[model samples]
Target: MAEIQTTTLIDDLTGKPLDAEKAHRIHFSVEGKTYRLDVDEKGADEFHAALDRFIEVSTKVAAGGASKRAAAAPRRASAGSGEQTKMREWAKANGYEVAERGRIPAAIQEAYAAAN
Candidate 1:
């Protein structure tokens, strides 16, 4: 029979040594709550698998968020364009204290857009 060899486990990110019990456990936090998941000797592999899935899903979500903002950029640009200057002038003429430069109020923008 061959002798079984035992080795210490180390956390890749924290650079901390883990004993057998801890090495067989995964720790995580969600919404201010902390939780631990214990597994058999396959725990290390399972933890890595979960981490991979989390990264993949979050990456997709982040990409979708960026695209949503990109899609809104054109509307934001139009809001500050010459149409807004025309609206500000209209609002000031109609007794609304329009700012010299900055965001024009939504009511003024709506009325001007409707007028045009």
Candidate 2:
């Protein structure tokens, strides 16, 4: 049987650290099981569309938001323009998954590496 894991992806939708008062729980299923996770509620409804888009694109790119942003910075500094576009394209072509903060989820990383 396949193992089941739950992960929470955090975003500063309001440009600030998340507070418990404004959080939404989103559930996703893996291997026929369901997992519930929380998201910032401040922009839960308003940013849902963009968040969804970001997740979809990130899944395909296999890069985390922070890593992508970090990776793009140097390029932008050197080129002085359009670093985001370049990074996105580079990630897509490389089959990377974008994570919310560039840091790999411990569970996911462990599972992938069989470290646990």
Candidate 3:
């Protein structure tokens, strides 16, 4: 007898799995609500491409403070989809137990920023 195991990641928008690559997780905010999505490389690129123009023109905001724009819970990854992936990868490499999905911890985010 033989035993085998497999795990497949599906794209949130397309509900399809990539043949050779795992999906990337995307975190974004709109109107004050935040969301997380898992997508393949092409989908990740498309999401960022659609937002690049707006991102280039938008002012950067600090993550925490009494400032009006500060989120109720401190948030990270105003950075584009690629950068967000980098941050998550960095966190895992540096001994942080980041999940394959969901929010990365604030400490991990701060360390990533400081190191970069």
Candidate 4:
């Protein structure tokens, strides 16, 4: 048998942090197994659509009006302006070291994501 599970900070549909204590949980089973997960605002986007579908199909989670976090969706840098270029500029401006060429470091990416 194999199993996998993890938890991430739950958020509301608007991307605001949600109180774990007040959050609702959904429980269901598939293939002779059971699983439970808390409603998360950020869990239903395209990134987690497969899991969302799995949970939805196997349970009545949708009937309860839970919504996926939509505010965390990656913003597309305006066409021609580009996020990479902006990221490079922001790093330099903030005194964060960046490669002159090639992929930006993950730290930089995280910072950039948090900023924009």
> Which candidate tops lDDT?
3
RMSD of 3: 24.7
lDDT of 2 at 9: 50
TM-score of 4: 0.30
Q: On residues 21-82, what C-alpha lDDT tens digit does candidate 3 reach at each position? A: 55688887776567897988888899999999999998776653223654488644376777
Per-prediction backbone clash count = 0, 10, 0, 1
The candidate, 1 or 4, that scores higher on lDDT is: 1
lDDT of 4 by residue, 1-116 (tens): 99998665454344555567655555655544676755554454433576766657664554323444546888544324366788889999999988767777878888887887
lDDT of 2 by residue, 1-116 (tens): 99998643555443444555566766644434666755676455765674677667654433233344333443212322354344444444556564434443344443433521
Q: What is the C-alpha RMSD, rounded to one decimal, of candidate 2?
A: 25.6
The lDDT of each candidate is: 0.67, 0.49, 0.79, 0.64
Q: Is candidate 1 or candidate 3 better by lDDT?
A: 3
Stretches of candidate 4 above 4 Å error?
Answer: 1-81
**Model 4 accuracy (lDDT, Cα):** 0.64
What would the TM-scores of all predictions be? 0.38, 0.23, 0.46, 0.30
lDDT at position 90, candidate 1: 88
lDDT of 1 by residue, 1-116 (tens): 89998887665545567666656667765544667755554556767786887767663433234335334444544465676788888888888888888888778877777877
- TM-score of model 3 vs. true structure: 0.46
Give the CA lDDT, 0 to 100, for residue 76 in model 4. Answer: 40
